[model samples]
Target: MKRFLVAGALASTLLLAGCASGTGGLTTGSVDSISAVEPGMDSGMVTAEGLKTNADGSVASDASGSVSTDVSRSVIKTASVSVAVDHPLEVAPELATIAANAGGYVQDSSNSPASEYQSESIYVTLRIPADKFDAATAEVLALGTFVSSSQSESDVTLQVTDVDARIASLTTSVDRLTALMANATNTADLLAAESALAQRQAELDSLVSQRDYLSNQVDLATLSVSVIATTDAAPTSQSFWDGLSQGWSALVNAGSVFVVALGFLLPWLAILAVIAFAALVIIWLSIRASRRRHESSTPEE
Candidate 1:
């Protein structure tokens, strides 16, 4: 009996963990021949035979161990990318078109015109089908110089399983609570059931919302792209004045930067100058006094 308890606990823990990772949910559930969940049923209610996933992804179960996990979820892929192109404003739409071609669409987008301080930029958020994620990303990266890119993935399989289990538990609980309310002869019990029912309903609604969101995320991958206008290519030809004006600007910018740096260092330089002057005066006085003492000690010459 003790060994059964220990093994059951170990098995349940491992099953829960394996189901949480998306890789094992489908296989784990298949191996367990647990009864199906029906209306007003406890989803996690294990039977006399439930399966546990081993470290090697195999299932192990005996007559004494069973747990129910009927839910499975896919991976959610999200990415953030940045690129530099000749015309950011133009490239934004091209990226949208790429998504459309791949059976996806743009979720959000914004464009900023060029300014004196910075070039034009556009930000876009695209929703692409999971299968088309890589293709769309490659298209985007190819549009211009790939400045930076990052991507991440999330497996909501565990969360879906948890919420489903909770919803099942609450459904049955609500049914029982409703029955109690219907049979309650007193006001207190009736009010208590009503309160519990309301709480359960609220929680159930929230779980449904979460489940829907995860499902959407798993179906469609999200890509956030930032497109910035690349620096202008060096002109093939330039007039003399163009070169002179560019050189003048460069010179003026350098001078201005130098002046700013000098401004910051001026106070420190002044302090050092005063300390050096004082030290020189003191040294001069000490040398003169030493010479007088030497001449006096040498006798009248």
Candidate 2:
């Protein structure tokens, strides 16, 4: 009986040890799987079971360690241009039309009237589709004399891939938690699974929002345009007739200004004349008074 009891105790210990070792192995595998889904990991060091080369030579994967064949790149494009035009108001509508024809829309626009020092100008912000960015920019450049232009492109491929990986990982977690909740046999286990699910879902929602914002940026290109109305008309070599016409117009303008200025001074001129006359009258009266005094002093002369 003692031997039997000892044998039973030894078998129980071995069984418990085996079960613990299996559970530990499973835990380690789970951790490695999660790490494999993270981006920027060295493929040589990490297992490539879940990742596959896409058509564009990029790596893509999904939940459940499955690789996808579809591949795409994300880039954010932006441009700024300064142009000189004869009429900013006229150019503003032309720019709007150009954007529309290129499958773009005006995001914002402002027209400033001419000031003392600055000429009339129009500023336009446009959102064009990625495919139409270059063509639209070319058309906009054609609208007026190009003063300056600059374009920039930013690669967001790695950022997008990272976000996708995180989203996949979170989705897997949510799935696992759902399974846990379904299999829960007690109230405490059920409550724990539900709480974990809620947390993961919230995180997933946030990541989704971020991904959407990035996607929009990739899809649309931004272009800012400044159209300044030229203060002076461009200098051109002119024929004698044209020069003569311009000279006449200038002369007429100068004469009109002179006449207007003379009109403005007329009131002051009248006031000055009235004061001069009053001064002469006073001088004459003083001279007469002096003569009377001289005669009175001379007595009987």
After superposition of all CA atoms, the RMSD between model 2 and the true structure is 12.7
Instruction: Work out candidate 1's RMSD over C-alphas.
Output: 12.4
The lDDT per prediction is 0.70, 0.70
Q: Score residue 172 of candidate 2 by CA lDDT.
A: 64
Please give each candidate's TM-score.
0.56, 0.56
* Residue-by-residue lDDT tens digits, candidate 2, 1-301: 6445434443332232222112222111121222222233333211223235543556656676666644466789999998888888788888888889888889999988888656888899998989999999999888888778999998876666656665765676677677666766667666766765676677667768878988988988999999887644344467899899989999998999999999999999999999999999999999999999998899673
How well does candidate 2 match the true structure in TM-score terms? 0.56
Q: What are the runs in model 2 whose C-alpha is more than 4 Å off?
A: 1-70, 232-301
Question: Worst lDDT window (10 residues) for model 1?
Answer: 22-31
- What's the lDDT for residue 111 in model 2? 88
